[model samples]
Target chain A: MSGVLTISQPGNSVVTDLGRFRGPRYGLPVNGALDQFSARAANILAGNEDNDPLIEITALDFRLRTDTDILVAVTGAPVTLSVGGRTCPQWEPVSVRAGETLAVRGMTGGLRAYLAVHGSVAAPVLLGSCAPDTVVGFGLKLAEGTQLEVRRSVAPIRQPYFDLPLFRLGLSRPEFGTELVVDVTDGPDIDEFGDSAGLLFSSSFTVSGRSNHIGLRLGGELPERQSSAELLSRGVPVGAVEVPSRDELLVLHRGRGVTAGYPVLAVVTSMSLDILAQARPGHTVTFRRTTVAEAAGALRTATRQLENLRAAVTTVFGLLGIGAQPQWHDLAPAVGS
Target chain B: MPVNAAAIEVHESGDSALRVVAVDADREANWTTVHRLAEWLESSGADGVYGAVPTYDSVLVEFDARSTSARQVKAFVQLGLRQLGHADTQVRAPREFDVPVVYGGEYGPDLERVAGQQGLSTEDVVRLHCAGSYVIRCLGAPAGSPMMDGPGFPLPVPRLKDPRLSVPAGAVAVAGRQAVIAPATAPGGWCVIGQTPLTLLNLANEPLVPYMPGDRLSFIPVPAADFGGYAGRYLEPAR
Candidate 1:
């Protein structure tokens, strides 16, 4: 049941799952796939559950050799994917023969890409997930010569051409235009900045090189706190836009610590988190104020799309006379939901 | 009487989370109420409640927005507050620990600077620091890192303007009026006064963290030569 996928060239990749959702209670960050939509899409295409462990490659140069025939899919930023010298398409399932070398090279758009394989990638699960959290010293950062043990699933599905409509609609790529506009809702400490809270939406910030999974550090005009009193440390959710003492803003991400002391001006909407995840160093970003109702609506729509994807996958499996994995239906709602 | 619903300010953290903040003036009372509320919410068989995190002055309740709304979470919290009316919440007794520490020298490089800032001799600084009983305010920053609050020094020591690249685990440090022992080697600004031999966060142990919020902590100064024995003894499982 177990097969090995040897990393011929790891590039900048890490093993990540949907994230460790329940770890925050124990003061652990909910580290997961930064571009969750792309991760899920890859999982769906590979005939795996949405939360199955996958490879998150940043600045793609990943190469792997499979020890057994494996169903695989690549999603997220547009990249050149090749298997045994034959160019393969992104955002669709592809089968690779045993000992075939699959290479993903030169991502053109988004900063990160997801490579999901059929069946579970057997990794040590800390807390409840296999997501690599570098901050917590958990999980692995795949490198050249790394061997990933995978439990091969025996599904009967064999479709030559299966394309999801959502993939054609540019749903996989992050919105990385000249200016990335992210939607945010007012945070608990919004009023602490007084009238300057409006500055959060108005100011344009450049993502600093210091940015990582922990947070996206932005260099720009920071909103000044009207009150001189210090804020008590409290639980901060992922996507919290925290303004510290320095002239920089930090948008906490999936790998953020459990608690933070800086005043959080706004929280990025769940739907817009994927956009932030793809923001590379030097990208200019601006926030747009949105209401909770609108944010919730956006999240609901995204969840429904994933649900549709799940159904579509089930249909494809059924049409091909393959049994749909029951675990695929257990896809949890995206962050905050 | 139960704290009035109006007394607590509910702020929407995001679409799916709400932060219920206690009035800032009464630190102890506010923290107590928040802790009790958090305990109640965790114990309650309420649908859609993801989890509640209690801090010094607030409880952030994260709910499943797919099934529950922010408004509904606030209402549930208000109901819990009402139910707590007039009843003194029986909190678990604070667990007291005598942490053996080796002060000054290699374990704590900032001890001399801390002593100088306090206008006291190095011996006197360690004596005063170990004298006060500290209370764990929260476990945060890093997993199982206890943030404890206690009596302040004669002159409060400020956090390092330039934080250290890496502070070793078990390095007991002070910043503002709070004290913390690093759970893992991490970059921090706190002034390190001593290092404890006890493992603060051993995942292999039955209880991962040695202390939780509301626990009492007191430092015991020990000779550096005896540090190894204490470290080994603390790591031993109870027979």
Candidate 2:
């Protein structure tokens, strides 16, 4: 079977991974899946590596048709996932025959969803990643009728996708909705914000439409600072919450710059990034203060869950006779029939 | 100036990264040391440490938290900190860049405004900018945007009260005695007085921007008609 997927209705879809390795040092933002937990879940369920390139569909109306039989999964936000008119539950692997239409629509919860096909996106890898950053001229957005070249392995499935008696998999996915309470630790320059620092936790800020992979802009009651003094530009992390002068509060994300001029009022916990990334315009956002120890523990727990997930998915893939090519996994090389 | 652990304050930048602020009263000295520390960490093969980004006052070190704990990464950072300013470590040689610019008109929309603020003719402002020596203070956001010192014109001009929503890439801008070339189209507050046709930072040419801190810089005016000739060429820094 020809391994190709044609975009029938591309809704802001782009190839993304964990972004380029060490991208910040070269002035490139880490342009990857905003909600990584969902991305990994989609991949694991599809019998692919966690960080493999996959399609990240934003908002709604993302539809594609497969040119070959493949195992796939859709995760992130509560969405209507339909394959050839058959509705399927998310986070579960499904077999799609050639010429079948896979549609994801009516996202009720999150703003972005991850679609992992059991194939590799045939996009040119720049600096160790297929993720595109328009600022750097790396890759382009997927267009309607554009056929994405995919490399597939001769993986076998026991039966049809809709008829498979698979157990529903439950994992620790962040709650996605219109409202979000993000956990944050102390930022490097928290002291300069003065008593106004409490304003961040006290007020609810509405997400702005201007937000993107770079950062999320929140508009609401402005927090005044004690100093108008010039702070030298410094390297900032992705989760840094910045207070730009006379502007809205900005939470830096994956596509944020390595450095900025704004003063950081708080730093969002890494575990909360998945929830923060899915926030849409007009979404109400509140902050919760947390200790550093708790933040690290959250990540530790998530890491262990993913490790166990990989083991479970890999075992199931073996039982179903779905094996990847030598390139994907040499230890379990597939005998392409 | 001696670099010490006490002089550097490490703050938690999310769970996976650390923001190390170098406390030095002198801005130039602070950035120079920060740049040195970043270069050392990169050139050496440090385990678990991903990358270190240096700016005017601090460094952000992002690491693989799954393999390394925050305490382990912090210890690695401390080890790297101790290696700074040592005579044994090879230092990056500073170079010079002659950036070509097309001043005035569409390329420099604020040429007239900058001239008026400085109480001089636009030609004088251009000439002074061309003659003034500048140094890249740091490479930063929006794709290695070079923040620089010495605009070559008089007066430490204040930034725009309302920053322009979109400053085009390659636009030569100045604010508060500093000059910058927008590496990409982004929101900025600096006065755009000119533009460079040469590619400042491109992955195909060089991953890192050609010039770094301590590099000498001076602008050269190019005829508007000849601007197209220099487009797409890499910025070649010379010693």
Candidate 3:
């Protein structure tokens, strides 16, 4: 029920989970998957729970050798998957034989990729999650010679060629590019900037090098606030677009601190968070204003689509008599039990 | 009488969260309202309420958009405020702590500079710093890093124009009318005054953060040798 994965080549990657949602209560950031949709899709394809621990491969050259047979799915940033020199399809469940090396390389169109195995990757869970928060020194980073313990014995699920369409349909394939139009809702401090708030939507910004899970610092026209009054520190949620000292625009991300002193002019919509996650350092972005109702509607639609995908995938697995582990059973229970 | 709906402004932060801000100009009143609202939210066990983080003047209530809307969360906060009334809620007797520190040495490189700026001796600066009973306004920047507001110095101790690349953990620093202990080594603009040996955050403990908002803190100068022993004795097992 346990297998060891030895890291032969660990690209810039970290072990991540759904992230610690309750982290803010302790003044800690919610450290989790940057692209949650892709992470969950990988988990569903791997027949594991959506919240199960997975590897977030940031750099392209990630390689690992499994000591035992295991089922795994690689999603997010389009990457070439290979096992012992044999090319394998991304976003589909692939069984790696014992002593075989799985290589993920030539990443394109995105900044991160997710690798989810059956059952879950066993790691030390601090504060209810295994996602790495480098700021707090929590969780582990994949490196060469690192050993990853994955629990659960996976049985290979065979599928006919006709089932490929259904499997492909269930997989999440996000278009990655340099220019992105991110949707945002009015922030708590939107009025602080007065007329300058309009500039946020009109101006284009380039993602600066100072970008990480904590925030995506944008280099663009500085938006000035009307008043120079000292504002009190307040809770800053994920996707907060904060303008600190009229220097640069910073969009807080999953690993953002609980509170920030700067005024937030807008918050990125939940639907566009996945697109923002794929933005690279040189990526250009423009904020598109959206109503809260519209943003919420879009999020609901995205969520419903994911639910439908999960149901379709579950049905396909059931028809094939594949006893795939129920990851997100809220959509549909595993039928072939 | 209706909790002065005008006194509290509920603003939407994104589609899923609402930022409840007390419009009181008085800092203490604002914090008091936020703290009480946070307590009510925590105790009410409201469904779809993820959690509420109390800041200096506001509380951000995060909710599950799939289950609840921002408007619903605002109504919940308003209802909680109405039940509590306009008068400030009874402030609980804050838990007091005697934090031991070693000042004016390698631990506090800027101690001499701070004392010089205030036209006081290093000993006088330490005395003035330890004299006041500081209240923990909030825990921020990092986990368990308490931002305590205390008595103002003889002269305003402005933050470093150029922040240090890193300040060691447990380093006591002051900026404006506030003093804070570094929870972990981080780049900060606060002027370093001293260093404390006390552990503010320990994951091994049941309650990760040793102190919370509204706690009272006082510093006691101890020799470097006595720090280790004093910390071991003062450090309480997380509840």
Per-prediction DockQ: 0.61, 0.67, 0.69
Candidate 1 structure lDDT? 0.79
Q: Cα deviation of B239 in candidate 2 (Å)?
A: 3.8
Q: What TM-score should be assigned to candidate 2?
A: 0.93
What are the clashing pairs of model 1?
A: none
Q: lDDT by residue for model 1 over B66-152, one digit each (tens)? A: 677888888899888887655666778788878888998999889999888888899988888888788888778776577887546
- Who wins the DockQ comparison? 3
Instruction: Assess each prediction's global lDDT (C-alpha) against the native.
Output: 0.79, 0.80, 0.80
Chain A of model 1 scored by TM-score: 0.89
Cα lDDT tens digits, model 2, B67-99, are: 776787778778877866444555556788888
Query: Candidate 2's residue-wise lDDT over A1-337, tens digit each?
Result: 4577889999888988877766788777877888888888888878778889898989868899986676788888888999899887788887777788999999867889898987656676777788888776677488998877666644435445867657455665668878799999988788888888998999899999999988899998777777888777788888899878466988998888877777888889877888887898889999999976788888778888888877888777766566633434222222231
Give the TM-score comparing model 1 with the true structure, all chains together: 0.91
Which scores greater on lDDT, model 1 or model 2? Answer: 2
Fnat per model, in the order shown? 0.51, 0.69, 0.68
| lDDT for each residue of candidate 3 in B71-185, tens digit (9 for 90 to 100) | 7888888889988785655656678777788887887888999989889898888888989778888878766578887545777687898899888878999887778888777
Each candidate structure's TM-score, on Cα atoms with residue i matched to residue i, is 0.91, 0.93, 0.92
Better of 1 and 2 by DockQ: 2
Comparing to the true complex, what docking class would candidate 1 get? medium
Q: Which has the better lDDT: candidate 1, or candidate 3?
A: 3
